[model samples]
Target: MYIVRFLRCLVLLLVGLATVTHARAADEDLERVAITRALTDYIDGSAHARPEQLRRAFHPDARLLLSRPGTAYWPVSVDEYVGWFSGAKAGQPTGRIGNVLSIDVEADTATVKAEILVPSQGARFIDLFLLRKLDAQWKIVAKTATREPSRRSADRVLFVLSSAKFHGASRLPAGVSFGEVVEAWDAFRAAGLTVDFVSPEGNAAPINVTEAGEFRSRFYDADLMYALEHTHAPSQIDPARYRAVYFVGGSNAIYGVPENSRLQDIARHVYERNGGVVSAVCHGTAGLVNLKLSDGSYLIGGKRVSGYPEEFERQDAAYFKEFPFLIRKTVESRGGTFLTSARDQGYVVVDGRLVTGQNYLSAKQVAQAVVAILRKPADQQPKQAAEKG
Candidate 1:
């Protein structure tokens, strides 16, 4: 009887510990959200010349520290900083764009790093901020910034992911390849390019991670996960702001994405109208099979495309049976010349503005190719196969 009572007590204690752990995790998530909100307010407020938002983001006593040509130190109060933008009309273009690069939080204190770009001036500024959670609100308490010459464009890249979490009408799990997403993301970021995520259904994109390694461990952070969980819907994206659109692949890539008309339009706009690259890897190539240009010609028509062909799939597998269409066959039927390399080999085809990769191994290469093209002068960019009418 003593042993039974002791076991019961132990179980209760374990459950209580688990409950406490969960509560702490929940609190951390809330804190992260609050911190992000505060940072966004600062970024948007300054960019859009909104004084109220700037006031809300920073504490009244906050100071902006700077350095001048001959001065060792320069300091400006929050009021003085806000007044600098007071004369500018709200919601008008200031030729300034800001993005939060990183955030670190400890207890009630946090540090944030952000980048501000002034395209017109060809300048970039790095802003480091100290924030504190006070009275249930996060506020920037101090800010220090440095400016440098920059030539990088303000354009971003959009990563297209599917919303499918399972094989059609079956219990077999399916999701976007986490490996492909991370590989391409790393390459783009390394090239000083910003990336955004979008999905057909607009919310959290389901992810499939088969193995753990350096890239996985490195990118599996709260920021990336949160972006994936809150991906923009097709309607929210402005294709003009992106230099490229890359479709990520996995079993989930076979569904929802290929036939989504809105996604198709966004890709078309990016490619035909905005003169941006349209790329895909592995099963992600399915997204390109149905994309049509403004002239009503298939985007991949007569183009050399690479993807995971049907010959590589286990035709007998349950997952393969659920595929709405075979990637290689569909591409061929759409007037594309389907190409591939040996199983698991990295292979990419750059046909004009269309870029496609054979497998996950080629994901980074595809992104690099897109970045190369984007880095070129406008006159040097590959001519579109079908220009918008």
Candidate 2:
């Protein structure tokens, strides 16, 4: 009677162990399927800009937390976050590509790490998702995000636009080149530099709307368009706030840029302190002609530079006759060793902190040069080629 009772008890214990093992395996399989579904929904919603997909993927109470450099936390609710895709055009690369890096599960809670790239806006984001099992379903409850720098992480650039709409002498409608500004703006943005627009007059700068080429037109999104219309004036800018300052070129630049005392002081402050790079392209070099350092020496004197060639001026006799001064001649007279390449081709010269581009075609190259200079340590920075006497 005792042996029979013991055997019965052992049989019951083995049955209970098997039941527990099966239940645990089933739970793990369910978790895997639910996690994958949530991730798929997120990718489709973001890449396609479909609010419905996003709505399904995220919990009603989910919040997106963004960490900005040296700034306070910015939180966005699900509805507010979906609003960003309201204007997205179908099939356009909105820079919303996402890749799952890893996913971890712990009982009722899970965490996922993902990378999102927004090429249009020149941004890459690292996102962390927190999820919980509610009503036997997994939904993203919160997300924390940080941006990964695409280039030199800490660089900030200032793009100086000409506020003059027409040259007083030439009577031509000239302000800033739409192509020049947008090209360099996009390049600098892609390289992860924070760019601010400023002008000599602190008013809306004119752009040659018709001058936007294929590249410029492709990138002229709402944000770029808005920034051009709301540029700040020189008086409104603080020199110390930027790591580089680029003078955008146009015929009107000849009217107010070189002679503006305030602009000169700002450039001097940036260059003298060795705090940043100073650059100009095309006719914008006119601005550099009279810039004197704090030591009372001309900024471009004995420095290598380039700008709009004399040939371009000669190409149009009527236009040339009405100009204030030839760009190349002014630069040379200022003791700058002017350099050039084939006309209309991009030619950029980097002389330490001073950079110059030959024409509108070179605008992008000049901006890139500024970024390169800012990336290096002060002690390891390349020295300017031997200056001319």
Candidate with best TM-score: 1
Residue pairs of candidate 2 with colliding backbone atoms: 95-118, 202-233
Highest lDDT against the true fold, candidate: 1
Off by over 4 Å in 2: 1-152, 216-220, 314-317, 386-389
**Stretches of candidate 1 exceeding 4 Å from the true structure:** 1-41, 48-75, 86-95, 100-114, 118-152, 212-214, 219-226, 383-389
lDDT minimum window of 10 residues, candidate 2: 86-95
lDDT by residue (tens digit), candidate 2, 329-381 = 88888788888877847888888889888888888888878777787989867
CA lDDT of each prediction against the hidden true structure: 0.86, 0.77
- Error at 343, model 1, angstroms: 2.1
- Candidate 1 lDDT, tens digit per residue, 1-389? 99999999999999999999999877776787799899988888888888888778999999889777897589988988888667746666677888776667789999988889897898888999999999989999999999998775677999999999999889999998988988998789778777889998886798886542456774457667767776888997878888899999988998999999999988998987888999999889999999998899999888988899999999999998888899999999999988777886788888888988888888999999899888898788776432110
lDDT of 1 at 180: 90
What is candidate 2's CA lDDT for residue 188? 92
